[model samples]
Target: MIPVGAYARVSEDKALRANAADWREIGEQVAEQFKDMDALAAELGVTITRRYNDNNRPAGDPHIVRNDFEALLVDLENGTVRGILFYHSDRLVRQEYDAARINRLFQLNPTYVGRAVAGGTDLSTQEGRSMLTIQATMGGMEVYSTRRRVARKNKGLAERGHIHGGPRPFGWAEDRRTLHDTEAEELRKAVLAIPGGLTVGEIRKQWIDLGYEPTRNKKKPGTQTLQHSTVETRLINPRICGYRTYLPQAERRDAKRPWMPDFVVRKDGKPVMGNWEAIVSPEEWQACVATIEERKRARVEGRAAHTTSAKYLLSGIARCGKCSFPLMSNQYSKGTASHERYGYRYACLTTLGGCGGVTRVGPPMEHMVEEAFLLEVRRSLGTVAGQVEINETKHDVRLARIDQEIAEVSERRRAKRISMSTALDLIEELEGERDELNRQRRQLVAAKVRRQNISPSLPEEWKGYSVSQRKIRLRESIRAVMVHPAGRGRRFDPSLIEVVWIEGGK
Candidate 1:
C-alpha cells in the first residue's frame, strides 16, 4: 500500500470554545475526521503512516502560525510520506499563497499524491490544483465577510451602550450592569487616590491586604493575585465612569497603544454613557486620567522618582536652602562621651549634588511640619466647604452650556450645514472649555472630601494616618521645607527651618 499523511484542522469558532473541560468535544470531532480520512485512504489503497492535526488553530488568518501544518509541509518536502490526505480542500489550504506552495511541492515531487475525502480531488493533478486554489480563495472571502458582519454588529452595540461579551469587569457583577458593592467602592477609592499622588502599586497592595481579588482567571482557576497592571487598567477604564469605549481590533491588539479619550465612543462630542451605574464621577475620572498622563510624561522625560511609598515624612519634599536640591533621608551618627548615638536625619548629601549645607533631625522637623499642617487644615476646612459648593454649582451651569454647543456643532456637521473644518474648529474650542470646567469641578470635589475627612479632632485623627497618607496631606498644605545651614552648637533652633506653605496659608 502507498504511504500517505492525514491532516485535520479545527474550525476557528470551535477553537474559541476550547478549554480543559470542552476539549473532549473537540477531540471527538477531530477523531471522526481522522476516521473518515482513514476510510478514504483504505479505499484508495494507501496506508496512513502519520497524522497531523492543528487543533484549535485558525487557518484563514495568515498571521497565526500553524506549527503542525508547517511540519506536514516539511515531511512532504523530505519524502517522509509519498502523499497527503485531508477531510476537505479548504481545511488543507485556506489561502491562495498556501495552495501555491503546495502546488510547487507537488511539481517538485511528481510521485507525490494529495487527496481530500470531501472533494475527492487528486491535488497532484493540474485540474485538482486549480480546484484547490478556487476553494482557498472562496475560504478567504468568507473569512473577510464574517469579520465585516461582526464588526458592524459590535459597532451598533457600542453606540447603543450594550455590554459586549468579555470576562466580567472588576467593579461590575457578572451581568456587567449591576455594581458589585465592595469592588465598586474599592474602585472609587482608587480613582480618588490616584489624583492625590497614590501609585498603582500602593493601591494594589491595599487591595491585597483587604482580601480583594480580581476576576478569576478562566485558564488558571486557582490564581487570584491582583497585579499592578490590572489595577492600573481598571482605574483607567472609562466604564467605571459610565462611558462605553470601543477601539478597532488592530488598536485593541496593539500593546503599545496609550489610553486616551479617543477610545471612548462619542456622539456629537459627548461621551456615550453606558447603561450601568457610574462608580466614580466624570470629573474624578478625568482627574485620574490627567494624573496618569502626567506620570507617563514624567517617565518618558526621565524625571519621575521611584514610586515606592515614602518612609520619611519629608524626605523628597524638603530642599536645601543653599542649593535648592531635594534632601535625602539618612542616618547620621553623633559622637558622645562613651558611645555613638545614631538618629534619622534629612541631609543635603554632596554625593547627590547637594551643597551639604543642611541637616536636621527627622523627629523635630516632622513634628513642626505636622503642627503647621494641622493648623492649616483646620483653618481651610471651615472656608472650603461653602466655597466648593458654590464653585461646583457654577461649573455645572457652564459645563451644560458647553455640552449643548458641542452637540449643536456636531448636528450641523452631520446635516451638511457646516464644513468639516468649521465643525472641528468649533468642537475643539468647546472641548477645551469643557475640560477646564471638569478640572475645576474635580478640584472642588477633592477639596470637599478633604474637608469632610478633617474634624475638630484633626490632631487625634491625624495620628491614625499612615506615613503615605500624611505625606499627601502635607503636600496639599505645604509646598516645601527649606532648611538653612545651622551654626555649630545651635540648640535645635526652629529659626533655621522655614516652612513654605502652599498658597492661602498663614
Candidate 2:
C-alpha cells in the first residue's frame, strides 16, 4: 500500500460541532494496515510515502478546503505515495462530489484506493469492488440523511409565518447572545451603512469596529460581515426571507410538487413565507442594497474603500479651522474609578511628528473648539432665516416617498396576485429602501442643524462633564480613537484620538 491522504468534513458553523470518535478509532486501525504496507514497499526497494490525516471543515469555512488534500490526492494518483489512508469511506468524503477530486483518484490510481476496515477490498477483484461500492454508498447516504433531517425542520418552521433566524452571521453573531437592544440596533445600522458589494474582507473590518473579530485559524480570516458573497448566497436561500429551498433528487420524476416533506417549492407559482421571525427588518436590508450599489461604483472606479477625514461630535470635524488636519484625540484616566475618558484637541495640520504653529493642548483647549465650532454656528444661524422651511420641505418629500412605495406594495398584497413569498420580498426591498432613505434624511437633518445657529457651546452643565460623560462622548463621536501610550501603558498622556462622526455635519 502507498501513502494516502484522509479527511473528514466538518462545517465550522452551527452545522456541526463535533465528529464521532468511532470514525477516528477506525482511522487509527487503518493506519496499522498502511504501516504493514510500508514494510512491503521497503522490500520492493521503494519508500512508503507519508500519510495525511485531516479534519474536514465546510468548504465555506476557510480552513476546510485545504490545498494539501488535493495535493495528496495528486501524489497518490502519480504514485508519489502508495495510496490514501483513512478510517472509513465517509471519513474521506461524505459524498462523491464530482470536481476532479477523489473521482480522479479512482481512475488514475486504480490500485490506490485505501480505507480503514473494508474487509480486504481490491478493485481488481470482483469481491473487493462490491465491498468498496457498498461502503461508498453507505457513506454518501449518511450525509444525505443528515441534510434531509435538517431540511425537514426548516420547512416545518416556514409554514408558521413566524420570522426564523439561525445562529446570526458574523457581525450579528452576538445579537442573541448579548441581547442588547443597542447592539441589535448597531447591527442594523452597520448593515444599513455598509457600502454593499464589499468583499468578505471589507465589511468585516467595519464589523470589527463594533467589536467582533473573525475566528480565523492559520491566518485565514473567516467571514463575519454581510459581503457580496454572503448576499449572493442569501438571495437564493429561502430560509433568510422565510422559505425552505431545496433541490430534491426525487425531482428526476414528474414535478410532484416537491413532495419530499422536507423540501419546499413555489406553490402554484406563488412564493410561500415561513413562520419565522425576521431578524433583519426589510428597511435595513435595503440600506445594505444601496451600500452594495455604492460599493459597485467604488470598485468600477478602481479605488479601495476611500479613507476620509475623521469626525467627532463637533470638534474633530472642525479642524484647527486654521490647520485643516483632523483634530487630535486626548485621553485621561480616573484616579478613583480607574476608568479612562477621552477628548479631542486639534493641532496644526502642517505638523507631523512635531507641531507646526501648534503644540500639545489639554482638555482645557476642548472649550475653545466647542465655542469656535459649535456655538459660533448657533450664533451665525440665529441671524439667518429659512431653516424651518427647508427642514419641513425635506421631511415632507422623504415621508411622501416612503408612504407611496409602502402603499403600492400593500395594494399588490390585497389583490392576492403575487405569492406570499414574492409579496414578502417586495416588502423587504421596500422596507430596506425606506430605511436607507430615512438614515440619509437623518444625516441631512443633522447637517442642517450644524449649518444653523445651533448651540455648539458645551452647556454649563456639560462644562462639568466627568470622565464617564467624556467616555460616552468619545464613543459617540469616534469609532476608534487611538491613544498611543508613548509614555508606556502606565499613563496615557497626549493621546492621539481618531474620531469618526456618527451623525450630523461631522
Candidate 3:
C-alpha cells in the first residue's frame, strides 16, 4: 500500500456550542468525517501514515493560521507522504492563497495524488487541477456570502436590541431579556457604590467570595476564572443601563483596548435602547463610567491607589517640606516593658528620594490635619453652593466639542486625507484633552454628591470615615500637608504641620 496523509478541519464557529451535548454532537460529526476519509483511502489501496486535524480553526480568515495544514504541506514537500487525502475539497482549501500553495506543491511533485472522500483529483492531470481550482474558488465565494449574511443578521439584532448568539451576558438570564435576580442586584449595587468610593478590586473580592463565576466560564467549564479586567469591562458596558453595544468580532478579540464611546450602538447620535430591563438608571451608569475612567487614568499616570506599607490618612498625600517627597507611613519598635511598644509615624526616608529630615507622630499630626480639613470643608460649603453645576455644564460642552473633533480626525484618516502619523498625533492630543475634562467633571460630580450627603454634624461624621475616604477628602480640600522638621527634643507640635488648602479651599 502507498503511504499518504489525511487532513481534516472544523471551523471554530461551526464547532463551538454552549452545552456539552451539542459539543459531543460536533465531535461525533468530526470523527465521522475522518472515518469516511479512512474508507476512501482503503478503496484507493493507500495507507494513512499521518493524520492532520485543525480543530476549531477557520480556513478563510487570514488572521487564523492553521498549523496542522502547514505541517501537512511540509511533510508532502519532504516526500514523507506520496499523496494527501481529505474529507472534501472545500474542507482542504477555502482561500485562493491556500489553493495556490497546494497547486505549487503538486507542480513540484507531479506524481503526488490528492484525493477526497467525496471525489478524487489526480494533480498530474490538467483536468483534475482545473476541477480543484474551481472548487476552491467556489468555496471562497461561499465563505464571503456566509460572512455577509451573518453580519447583516447581527446588525439587525443589535438595532432591535436583541441578543445575538453568544455566551449569556452577566446580570441577564439565559433568555437574555429577563434579569438574573442575584447578579442583577449585585451589579446595581456595584454601579451605585463605585461613585461612592467602592473600588473595582473590592467588588471583585466580593463577587469571588459570593461564589460568582464569569459568564464566559460557562462555555468551557473550569477553564476561565474571574479577573479584575473582566469586572471592569462588565461595569463599563452600556448594556447594564439598557443600551445596546455592537462590537465587531475583531474589536472583541482586542480585549486590551480601553473602552471607548464608539462601541455603543447609536442611532442619530444617541444610544440604541436595549430590549432588556435596565438594572440601573442612565445617570447612575454614567457616573460609574466616569469614576472607572478616572481611576483607569490615575493608574496609567501612577497618581492614585498607592499600595503603602499602611493605610495611613496622609501616606501619599503629605509631602516633606525640605525635599518635597511624599511621606510614607512607618512603624518603629520602642523599649519593651511586658511587650514591645510600637510607635507609628510618617517619615521621609532618604531611600525614597526624601531629605530624611521630616518625621511626625501619626495620631497627633493626623488629628490636626483632620481638624483643618473639616474647617476648610465647612468654609467652602457656603461659597461653592451653585458653582459645581455651572462648571459641569461648561465641561460637558467642551467634551462634546472635543468628541466632534476626534470624529472628524478619524474620518479624515479613513478617507486617506491625512497621513497616518498626523492622524494618530491629532487623535492622541484630543483624547488626552477629553480625558482631563472627564476627570475634572467627575471630581465636580463627586463633590456635589459629597456636599449633598454632608450633615450638620460634620466633626462626628468625619470620625466615621474610612482611611481611604479621609484620604480622598483630604486630597480634594488640601493640596498637600507640608510636614516641616521640628527642633530636636521639641514636643509634638501641630505648628510644624502646615495645611496648604486647595484653590478656593477645595
TM-scores of all predicted structures: 0.81, 0.38, 0.79
> Between prediction 1 and prediction 3, which has the larger TM-score?
1
Instruction: Give per-residue CA lDDT, model 3, range 1-506, as digits (tens).
Output: 88899888777524454444455234555677789988988888889999888766778887788998999999999999988988887778888788888888888888787887876766657677777888888888998888888878888888877866767788989988799979999999888767656677778878888877777747675566688878887888788889887866655668656574446665544458988889987667767787777666776798875331126778777899888999988876556431243257888999978889998778788888888878766766546553535244557767677778888999999999999999999999987887677657655655555455455575677775556556666776689999998887787888788888777655
Error of 2 at 262 (Å): 31
lDDT of 3: 0.76
Estimate the Cα RMSD of every predicted model relative to the unseen true structure. 4.9, 14.0, 4.7
lDDT of 2 at 293: 42
- Give the per-residue Cα lDDT of candidate 2 at 476: 32
The per-residue C-alpha lDDT of model 3 at residue 137 equals: 85
RMSD of 2: 14.0
lDDT of 2 at 411: 87
lDDT by residue (172-191, candidate 1, tens digit) is: 88898999868999899889
TM-score winner: 1
